[model samples]
Target: MIGKLSMGAGAVGAISYCYYDKKATDGNGEKAVRGELLYSNEVFITKLPNTHLHLQYLAAQYHQVAQLNTKTEKFIWHQTFNFPPGENVSNETMVKIACDFAREFGFEHNQYLVFRHRDKPHEHFHIIANRINANGQNTATDRKNYERIQLFCREMENKYGLQVTKSKQKSYAQSSSVQADKLRKLIDKHLPTCQTLSELSIALKKQDVIMYLGRGISFTDRNSGVTFKGSALSRHYSRSQIESRLGKSLVLQAPNSKQIAISDQSGSKNLNTVIKSKFPSQKESLPVSKMISEHNNATETRKDLAKINESLRSVKNRKVKRRIN
Candidate 1:
């Protein structure tokens, strides 16, 4: 399951859309009746005539209590929880999860609405919550709120045996940069087992990719007419990082070569020799030593971050295990 929390300034606009299914469809055959409003709380009137008005009245109550009517308070906290395809979840279960999420984020005392829409391919529900709590104070909504949502989703996944997924922000925000990161993972997977530049080149070639080491290093996607610099993909996939693992002396004799040679003693000399002899058109674009120094620092920073994350995960796992025990 994936959860996404968004803050909005208008409660009326958001609540009206979810409450009335205002994105109404043309009445025809199967499209005529999409789905009825799933469920509502007893504290509010669910009838069409009074639902929106009642919600508006609740918002007015909060405004009166706070003694300030500000439209820019981000009074709406909208969240969507989506389930994997082929998973049939009931409205009761969804409402329970949605309520749990709201309560966990300190929204238990606030008035909210849950709508299960079957218009999408996957089973998903929308939650429209008031930002104001029962005490008329603004609910806590910040970066840490997102982290809490992520943790709550993980717990729900374990409890209900749902498909484990990364939080919505991390999963969706990185969609555009996924191709480069995938290339980095591919390099990390194949480069370590390769002892020579030639063997590494052959392994990468099998994957329909060409890694070039002329004046600099880069990976060319065979399927797409796209080129990514070594460091551009990731610091871990930097030219120096590749060379440090595969060997600093490794050089691609030619992009089409079936095999290349490796040497420990004449590594750097042979690299320069191959670049000059085979790929004379390409010249050293950037200082290799300087690039390596920068990437080395990045590598260390990444290592530190990994250690911290691992420590946190371990603590979380232990806490979960203790609860289970």
Candidate 2:
């Protein structure tokens, strides 16, 4: 499942958007509110005949209680929870899940309404609530609150056996082109902490991604077979950009070799001297005789890693399919 939380200043616009059936036009008989009023709590004293007017009146009452100097208080807290396609959930059950989620996320003290929209293939619900609590105090909604919403969503997913949405890191590791923006953010988070090429590779490997250490740096999603270059992701992650921060330590140290060598290291005495030399091309370059041999070895290593990663992905996919079935 995936969820989003948003806060805005106006209730009338928010409420109308939630309840409005955009499909119900005189030109087209679409719905003004595509979903049914599955549930509502503490929004009115009497059963008001008009749903639109009823929500507006309650929002107005909240505004009066707020009585703030500025009219731009973000009093409306809106959350939308979307389930995977093909999940057949009832409206009542959806409301129950939403209510449970709200309660878990500290919305129990607020008045809210739950509406389920069936217009789309995915089963989803919208929760509209007054951020102004019963005591007339505005609740704080910030980045931390957004994190809490995600935590509650996870709890609900586990409790109800709902489909779990892939995290940004996991999804980016899959190289989903659709999530390029999110992918950029994940790289931004992890890149700075990496001090060496091997360290970065190991770190990204933990995230199910592969980082190629060749001349041009690129990331490969082991699962989806998608690849992205640092330059393509963002200016901050471009080859020149990152190399300035971590490039001095970019060479991959050959295993078991005490000397710094790339492609060839037969006679190197001190690895420390080579690194300290700032990657002088003359010392690092292969002799004309052994150049072809070293190039082939590097190519083979890359191919072997690719094959292993593909095998691992196949096994993982089978496990997930079995569990879902």
RMSD to the native, candidate 2? 28.1
Would you list the C-alpha lDDT of every candidate in the order shown?
Answer: 0.66, 0.66
| Poorest lDDT segment (10 consecutive residues) of candidate 2 | 167-176
Q: Return the TM-score for candidate 1, rounded to 2 decimals.
A: 0.46
Residue pairs with colliding backbones in model 1 are none
Clashes counted in candidate 1 amount to 0
Q: Model 2 over residues 1-325: C-alpha lDDT tens digits?
A: 7778788877767766776765475334533556566777767633345333465585676566456524437777788888888987777668878788667666677778787788888888888877666666655445455446667667777887777865322122233457556556666666666654575677778877787644556776776656677766766666667655653444565654555633223343433334433343665565853888888999999999999999999999999999999
* Model 1: how far residue 134 lies from native, Å: 3.0
Q: What residue pairs clash in candidate 2, if any at all?
A: 20-32, 20-33, 21-31, 21-32, 21-33, 23-30, 23-31, 24-30, 24-31, 260-271
lDDT of 1 by residue, 1-325 (tens): 8888788776666665664544464544211333344554423543335223355764454345334435337767888888888888888789889778877876677667787778778998888777666556776555455447778889988987777875543211221376777777787778767766667778888987787775456776676535677777766666666766774334555664544545544355344223333332334535666689999999999999999999999999999999999
Please state the error at residue 35 of candidate 2 in Å.
Answer: 3.0
User: Any runs in candidate 2 off by more than 4 Å, and if so which?
Assistant: 26-31, 45-53, 68-72, 167-325
Q: Each model's RMSD to truth, in Å?
A: 26.6, 28.1
Each candidate's number of clashing pairs is 0, 10
